[model samples]
Target chain A: MSDTGQHSHDHTPRPDQDGPPSYYQAMETAVRELLIEKGVVTAEEVRAAVEAMDARSPAQGARVVARAWSDPKFKARLLKDGSAACAELGIDMGPTHLVVVANGDKLHNVIVCTLCSCYPRFLIGLPPDWYKARAYRSRVVREPRAVLGEFGTEIPDDWEVRVHDSTADMRYMVLPRRPEGTEGWSEEQLAGLVTRDCMIGVTLPKSP
Target chain B: MTARFGPGDRVRVRWAHPPGHIRTPYYVRGKTGVIERICGSFRDPEELAYARDGQPERPLYRVHFDRRTLWPDDQGRAKDGVEVEIFEPWLEPADAAMEGGT
Candidate 1:
């Protein structure tokens, strides 16, 4: 055997020793440490909050909205007032109030937080990585058709595409019209049709 | 905060330019349209991202635009229109309502 560490040829570091810490891990550690030092929040409380937050996914909200689209009575209630309407479906609007816009054959809806990334978190879970990206937020309002076209969505020549601006107090969600092939589908099947981009008004729902 | 504009109200998006600010896509600035709906109020992300949440809530409006108005080059169908959200601050009432009500 060679004298240099048994003549090993590999130079790459081991899994546990390789690479710099991730930004997420670093930020989390820093925030936790600071909180602990300041006594603003305990490590146990932080862990509990993170666990609870993770459990609050957007799937439930999507299901409620999808079911409402299939039910005329619920759709009517949603149109009347989304906050109360969501409650009827057992989905809490929570701290952020939301408005649900229904899209039809002649009318289409698109949502953007022109100033920032104001989104309907309750209905769609976390906004997609792209939604928070500068490329999308900056280009969406100015180039609606182009941006949507990139996502494989094309509004009809005669159909109108409406853009909803999300601001400080108000958040918006698009209730895309049910696709033709999905008739008689169950809520579970229908939920699959609801995409995060669709709810954000970037694309239409796909057939179940 | 209650919505300031209503369905069918005509308004224009105010041109905003901030140093090193990238926001509210440029093509839509100065475009005129009618309000379609009021999406409710929440913490403005622009403020929140800047770590300033003390500001009051701002009203969000859904505004509609004719396709012809947005894209002047006449190649596609004539009746196409687009709707986008605008804050109350970005809009001013237009002289007449379009097909929808204000």
Candidate 2:
């Protein structure tokens, strides 16, 4: 197996920027060792979970956006049932509600988890550091349009913006409005424009 | 499992501060909003966090609150809103007074 891109951040005790394990690291180590010692979960299982996390990336979500752009029926299905529609494209969404809020002419959508960092790992992989930062977690819910603006996305004043706070089990994705001037583009070509931020609703899909 | 609130139902989040692993945010406690969608049933996260079975699964809903309601100092132009995932136990029927006051 390739060692590149084979690292997991979820629950992984990473060293601080100053180059030492923080208290959280020590705590995580202790907890992990104890859990393993009790036979609750094997060390092998932990390694496998890390590998699975490593395998996931934004490309999975991009594939779904590309399919939706090319197929209207599929777009409708995705908006109606995100998990099932993703499954149709061979994506295995785990045990959580994958809610897709479509971006329309009159409305925009953004997502955040105020309590903790709960991202759609199956679709878009690990979230960026900014997404999990304390400031972002606190500010995004209160001022989403402003947050989007910080990302260089300018939404008109007229469009109603909706900030989705993922307080619990449900995970949300912003189905960005399809860009113009790309009539009859192949799904592969369309997928190129979908960035992780675009899928997250901070940015729009790039135009041709 | 039957759902207590459907889409468009106006509800008030009960303001309680019971200890240990709450999914509800502190800012949203005792807030009022409308149901955006039903999220089906799941074991209570509060109980699940403690390794409890969380028997009798509870229904979760996507609740939408007006931005002005959530943050009184919001500077947005129009009626931009915030939607949150809330379990059934935390929500109750919203009254006009509660909506306007809180």
Candidate 3:
């Protein structure tokens, strides 16, 4: 209902380029066949893994953001112990530790996997094509504000841009600041404002 | 595991050229930063690359770097910075000169 007045900006940043396919495909096929022949794993298992990643979406993360915005206690728990907080919220990421970084008056956090596409798939679904692109992986680290500008997010010149390179061992989700004017908005109403890009630190949550 | 550094501690990542998988970003190597928080130790990603269990787990610190030090040519905000998770073995205490860096 509240969504009617505003748009859901998932940012669905389309993939702008193709990956090195032939080399990776050949290597992947060879290794996969060998693994199957050796009985290390089954084709079904591989398919299931893909399916699991596909099953995840931004809504899982949006719920967490909505609750944190309305409930300060939950926000504290989410920031202090992200895994435990998500578990309580029923967003199961299956042991991959999640870290919630908060944006403030002077600082903002953006996520990028520099070495590879290491993401919190259980929480926010597949990495966008742009997310896995060389342009993003390389530029976001060196020039964050510039990359964010491509997404139409203009940060004030005074605020510090803290880019988080999700290299290994942990995954990150930006807890965007709740928009103003909806002082009495419901959690579902608030959830509508939170978008995938907002969680990625490229854009702010749209106002209702 | 005990944390060698905490939030606000100044540190520098050594620019080691490991032959295999590494989680540290190249842009951050040799750059000095302030410790944001200590992400508890886990399997070392380098060892994990070779399929070896990253045992004797290493502490990973969230280090904050100055935007200028990372991209010297950039004309962005002076207060802007970058935060990256770096394993303990790859980092060391920054010299006093580095501690004074923005």
Candidate 4:
């Protein structure tokens, strides 16, 4: 069958200045009004919940994991049991437990939620749109080297690339090894090296 | 369910046709490897992301495949091999064991 040239766009319309409501605005209003009318949830409650959620950030957990990478004992603990180790670093694991896989010279680790976007949300916060996108989920496990290469990581032929499927119950976070140029770096400095791509094992932490 | 494969056991990821939303990566498909470690059972993320709960947890396994096996045509001066995690449902034992088990 020849490929069709059809494209599907689901853009939500934006409101014109002092004009009629946009498509998204209309839908949002309809849903909110329906909820209020049905007495399911109040409009005020929705606004309050959104505001409270916006107040928190994932930086707290990132800092803890970064520090642990610089500390030998903490690194050991992190590998032994990541959830409890994260707590020691002041990061809560919440309802989900996490397992930290360390990437080194011999083994390279990459994580994917084969069934969905089950990430270590307690520590990493919400995953980016790409993390939940179909392209990533379908491509990463099938072509890890290529996908990782697009993210600027080139796995050497000699080093084994291990893709960790984050299916079933456990979540995964990659604790990348400290870069050579970053010796004696402070926790704050080290945190800068911990990018989302690195945590996902698609890229390595940047060196000094 | 218990893992049918274990660390050092060679296996292959069963090919899966992607539809709607899926998390299995595209590169590691059809690659063969030795089981490196068992990462325990958990909820499948594809189902969880879509709020499809009540699905049974499946055992997760980490498989290590040689880089040469993945890219036979490449000529780079570096260590060879790649390790990937596969659910119990995605793997089948290889007909013959390759080197570097465990």
Look at candidate 1 and tell me the lDDT of residue B57: 73
DockQ values per model: 0.38, 0.77, 0.76, 0.26
How would you encode candidate 3's per-residue C-alpha lDDT over B1-102 as one tens digit per residue? 788888998888886676888788778887888998888998887888899998879999889888888777888789988888899988888864344232
Please provide, for model 2 over A1-208, each residue's C-alpha lDDT reduced to its tens digit, 9 standing for 90 to 100. 5567867545867767776788999899999999999999999999999999889999999999989988999999998899999999999998757999999988888888888899999898999999999999998887787788999998889888888899888888888888898788898998999999988889888878
| Tens digit of per-residue lDDT, candidate 3, span A184-203 | 99999999999998998989
Better of 1 and 2 by lDDT: 2
DockQ of 1: 0.38
lDDT of 3 at B71: 71
Write the residue-wise lDDT of candidate 1 on A43-137 in tens digits. Answer: 89988967756666667666866778678898888877877888776777787666788898798788877666888776666777888788887
- Lowest summed lDDT over 10 consecutive residues: which window, candidate 3 chain A? A1-10
What clash count goes with each model? 19, 0, 0, 39
RMSD of 4: 9.1
Candidate 1: RMSD over Cα atoms? 7.5
Which sections of candidate 1 miss by over 4 Å?
A: A1-32, A181-183, B1-5, B15-29, B38-60, B67-90, B96-102
Local lDDT at A71 for model 3: 97
RMSD to the true structure for each prediction, in A, is: 7.5, 7.3, 7.1, 9.1
Against the reference, the lDDT scores of all candidates come to: 0.71, 0.87, 0.87, 0.73
Instruction: Give the runs in model 3 whose Cα sits over 4 Å from its true position.
Output: A1-23, A26-46, B96-102
Better of 1 and 4 by DockQ: 1
Rank list by lDDT: 2, 3, 4, 1
Model 4: per-residue lDDT, tens digit, A69-184? 67889888888788888888666677666778888877778888766787877777678888889899877756677888999899876677776666455788888777777777
Model 4, TM vs. native:
0.63
Error of 2 at B7 (Å): 1.0
